[model samples]
Target chain A: MASPVFRGKAITYGDDVNTDVIIPARYCTSFRAEELALHCMEDLDPEFLKKRRPGDLIVAGNNFGCGSSRENAPLAIMGAGIACVIAKSFARIFYRNSINIGLPILESPEAAQAIAEGHEIEVDLGAGRIRNLTTGASFTAHPFPEGIRAIMAAGGMVGFVRARLGVDAPAQPGRERKRSQG
Target chain B: MGMTIAEKILAAHAGVPVVRPGELYFAGLDLVMGTDVTTALSAEVFAQMGAQRVFDPDKVALVNDHFVPAKDIAAATLAQTMRRFAERYGIRHYYELGSSGICHTLVPDEGLVSPGDLVVGADSHTCTYGAVGAFATGIGSTDMAAAWALGESWFRVPETFRVIFRGRLPEWVGGKDLILRVVGDLGEDGARYKALEFVGDTIETLPMAGRFTVCNMAIEAGAKTGIIAADDATREYLKGRATRHGVYHRPDPDARYARTLEYDVSGLEPMVACPYSPANVKPISQVEALPIDQVVLGSCTNGRVEDFRIAATILKSRGVHPKLRLIAIPGSQAVFRQLLYEGIVAVLAEAGATISPPTCGPCIGGHMGVLGPGERGLFTTNRNFKGRNGHPTSEVYLSGPAVAAATAATGKITDPRTLMG
Candidate 1:
């Protein structure tokens, strides 16, 4: 099987950029993707919508999503047209929530440091390869393990679990693999 | 060569003889908690995942606390979704608007948690259960939905960072100061994805309220959970309180840790986090006579009955500063009742405190007393992020209940020790 690689322009941010700024509590009462995307980064960068294009990825400094367990933070980013987030590190819940929602994220201090804002970059989830097309810098990140990779390939935890339950059959207990999306 | 308490609990729940960090395993959940803020979303995800019925109705708990008194039409609808879902599934542990306060305090205060249990909740402060030695961590609603269906969920075991607190706590210092000191030292991301095992002489003598305070803010430093071993004190708290047979797990002295952090609290003072970040901390002695606009003394962080007692002690004969408003909230309904039974509520009211129902109102900027632009408020709650209380230009400061009350009396940040004299 060929490695699944994602490419996008890097939308960068600084360290400890917390959840309140990502999807402020004012918008957190609901989790609809479309509604949250409109307000994503509205608190931090008022022009995030104008600056971002669909399929763009975010590269940020240390501890990207630092506060709040609201999954809206990641979904808002996804809803805003970002494909992946590469950070120096992520708060535990943000990291897990991103992955559970099928949003690919990686931690690479080197990549987080060298990648310039709006630079073109490509990521390979299986090979853990991060290459900056503009700067030509290449760094390796910790890739998802097999189980996590499968879950992500199935388009997140809900879809993954549905595939495991054989598309809504109670007769079979769990762990039956099904074909997944790209 | 041996496991920490967190590792042991996860291994046991996963039905494994042992486990290692960075490895993935499916662990059975002992309890699953949700709130109005999270339950509707998780129920939607649960239905999408084709989960017809919850795996165990008895293990699920749903609370209406975030926008609880039904802030508006939307919040009321959210609560209705959670209630209807609970009724449909026959989930027995549901708490209505008046019955519960916050999910974290309500879960353990009602004895839904016991030592050495593997628990998960939809709120970030779910790590609060670690006070009793349970390996509880927060998950998003989607994960909660998956757990609702499977009674188990996948976990990547986290590395353990054991923080040992030594020396006697100084007068006017409590667990909030110690944890703030740790966060100030560790930085916001210092404990990312690691279990913080707090042990040593201080923890051995600390009260259950203080222990709960310490573990509650593990997330402030980006930790997966903060844990202490279940000792005699834990057993005493659990005696006739916990529903299940609680098993205490001890870490081998030789347990491998990612790192070890030690703090001597003998010289510690009340610590405060200033402005847009919890990691931006200073000892209250260093904080100058900064005036405040509001003083909110509640949330999962410092909203227990003991916290109220300390606040009432300082505010007994004094009144809230004429310039600022003071709001006191108990952590849960039980905590509120205890404060009332002890006449602490009357003292606070006489002191000009606006007593309110138990909810995570202003802590998350949900309602109650939100700050205006250029407004600065002090709170016993955690997270002083920009726009956390109200306006993006508004400011926030954080401390324990003592500093909060002292500040309330003075209209500026003041030390509680000065009030004692």
Candidate 2:
């Protein structure tokens, strides 16, 4: 099972970190997960690679991912192995995208201020807990709704659907289901 | 206890208890559409999830747009991903690049959508479909993957804001202007978590293209979706569409709105969205006459037959200023072919304009018409955000196609009203 708690350092940004800046338009056509990871945060800090740790958390102001509804932006972050993000608020698309990929995202300006770059921290989803390992300061997060948490715990929506419907993984090849009625 | 258009649509589709604004509800999404850029990723996510079959392949629309001619190998790969996925899933509504227009424009034209249905697309501009009375908005690829696998998603029903555009609009004033004015009045986040319903006589008189323009920019104002009640134009637009598609309308005589706000259309003027933000709007008259190096006159916004006709009228017999690199890109093949048949293309060329293939170029700073360093251009595209048209230093001012043509002819920020009379 994936860890319910995340431990990491911190990276901060201001409001409205649009999709264009997160992954830029030039990299939009590329489908390889590796190439996108290289471009993540390149717009804001070209040398982010040298500064980042594997489990570092990103802290941002309101409306992060406020521009295009591109999934690559969040996918790049998750691919790069960043553990979580705490922001004042999030663009609706980004919030949904982060959850869909099983990336933990918390909304708390207080915790955002408490953590600093290179500072160690821990986050627990089920318990709605966040702890700064460096300073020993702990905070709380709003746990996901029961249904959404179940889906997240299953690793994503697809896993949840497979489990609930009792369908085999990858449903049988050459088996196309008819359109379901609304 | 007011209900939003999103809530109403969900309630109607769910066929259960009433829903209020801000309340979260999970419902089966009626449709999910995507262009080349989106479908490719969605297919990948589906594969990662190990889902062999989509919840409803028939309801999934795959349109190969964004990079229409397959500009490079990467774009071609994305398009190919969509093709293979459509073939594997037995998707019926796959639109090839040449056959399709913009994804948002093509959805309604193909008759796959209807009123009161919840549509989630991977493109931000997908909200444009709300003009037809559907509760359409954008989502990301991952959320779209959920919709693909389960045929459903959750939404926080938004509050409703009734915007009444009354009286007659001035000649140069149009849909682009109306939407800009609405943004000005409401501020960028004023309508956050709210649905906008355009009502009153002025909106009733506007054409379908005009209504689409208004709905397209609803996202800029932070609204869930901008909508208008279905009327004669809606009926005519849907008349020739296939009968299998669902048709829905607003509640009769006693319809209710949460918060009603009115605007005097007659007082509004042509508007421009300054570089760096869509919310920074100013009257076109206030924009100084600065020389431009480029002029782009097409996009999902202001890229229709009527838009081209008005532009052609302005460009008739007048050559584009030698200093300006004028470009016109039709929104769709139909618009492109029709402009050629109607000789609008000849007029545009005679006026010294370069025509490009029908695709969104330079609107989001994608390939075709990137600006060089220190370049300044007047564009007919929506949103003139900083670096939107290539160089972060390049300045782009948003305007209607008519103003774009006029500016191209004069080589500066000139208004269409000056040339007309």
Candidate 3:
């Protein structure tokens, strides 16, 4: 799988956007990714689901995904057809959870400050480059380690581990296996 | 080179002579816990990963606490999934709705964790086990699935933040106040990816329940885990409940620290974390008389017997305000039983507080006592993030049991001292 080069319109938010606002605990009863996506960011912005376009990028402030260790927060973002998230900083658990689920999130302290809502941005995961098309400004984020990049390339930890154990085929970027139990 | 307790525990589990911060290793876990809300998903992931069996059944515990007694069809189905997974895997420590309490409390009460052990759980409050000197932290369901599959999980050794408490705590000021002060000073993400080592005279004298309360909120400050060196109090608390006894480790006096904070608790006042964030803390004196619609007095953080005892004392002759709704939930069945045996339950019931089973009711907004739009709640549960209780517009203030009881009596956020006086 090749590293991703994403270009999308950015939906921005401020600091400390917690999980409760991302996906409230009430909707967490469902384990299905698609089901969770329906309520993603519903409380914080009731129009988030309706307004979000496929491959849209979320640009947010520091400590994004701060409360609760719910993996559904990232899953919902991925299921909402979001391509990636760029934040000033992320909570520790959410950072790991996002990577484990193959949602590429970059941290650029300058990206949120410079980018405006509905700005079109380009991201190159391999090069760690984020460019704001609307402003013609670019910023660099810390690149993921080769191992993690490989896992993300594999669509997530499950696919990564399956490929490592020879139980599944090598992953193709952006292609995820259906998460149904046989 | 000297190491902190967290590093030492990680080293032992990783089968390495020594380890340092920033080093990643897969360490064997002594215990891995999950709740009904988490385990069902983890079980699905575990099956999806094609793991034939759990790495070690004895070291794993699955509890039904988050949606205990099954609040709805979805929650009941989730619980059923976990139950079947436990039965199929022959998991030795599965606790059903009536039998189990909160995972964080039940694991230790049942002797499932001990000092110097590496522990992980799906619930973020799993760090509560660190009160026993165990290296415990929370993980996501995917990581939990990996741990269940391999009996080991990867970790990045965290920098240690040394917090020393001096002087004696003032009356009515307990772990909740101390931890709130820490979060207030450090901010929510101040200790991100770091381990907290709580020490000094005040911590040494604190009861195990109080220690648990402090450790339970470590995650609120973004700490990977919070630890206190096991002492006589810890030993006594774990006396018959510990599955194993072993040498407990403490930080070397000269161990390097990322930062050291000293807190004098003699003058500390009861505190509250206001709406929107746990780090937005202020002394109860500052927010006194803020009208409240509800009061929640139980959770893993302050849901122990001692907390209820404090609440009962405050509510003894005083009745809850007619406009208020008070909900008291015990952390575990064990704590619930003590409430009954001591008649604390009766006291709360007579005072107009409704007693619920030992589930994480309304704390995570799952069920029971959920708030509506424009409502405000004062609770003992950790995390007051926006929309945390139930409705997005609803607000929550976090405080200790004493303040909760006082607030219930007056239907407002009142300082416990006002009632005590």
List the TM-score for candidate 2's chain B. 0.95
Worst 10 residues of 3 chain B by lDDT: B246-255
**Tens digits of per-residue lDDT for model 3, A1-182:** 67679999999999888888898888888978899999999989998998899999999998898878888899889889999999999988898789887788999999888998999999997778999999999999976756566667878777765664566655655455443321
Candidate 3 docking DockQ: 0.52
RMSD of each candidate? 3.8, 4.2, 4.4
Chain A superposition TM-score per model:
0.84, 0.83, 0.85
Query: Which portions of model 3 miss their true places by more than 4 Å?
Result: A146-150, A163-182
The per-model DockQ list reads: 0.64, 0.43, 0.52
Estimate, for each residue in B170-217, the C-alpha lDDT of model 2 and write its tens digit: 886789888888876775555765788888898899988888888888
Count clashing pairs, candidate 1.
Answer: 0
What does the lDDT read for residue A20 in candidate 3? 81
Candidate 1, residue A24: CA error in Å?
0.8
Kindly report which residue stretches of model 1 are placed more than 4 angstroms away from their true locations once superposed: A1-6, A124-127, A168-182
Error in Å for residue B353 of model 3: 1.1
Q: Candidate 3, residues B110-196: lDDT per residue as tens digits?
A: 989888989999988889999999999998899888788878887889999999999999887899999999999999889988999
Model 3, position B244, has a per-residue lDDT of 93
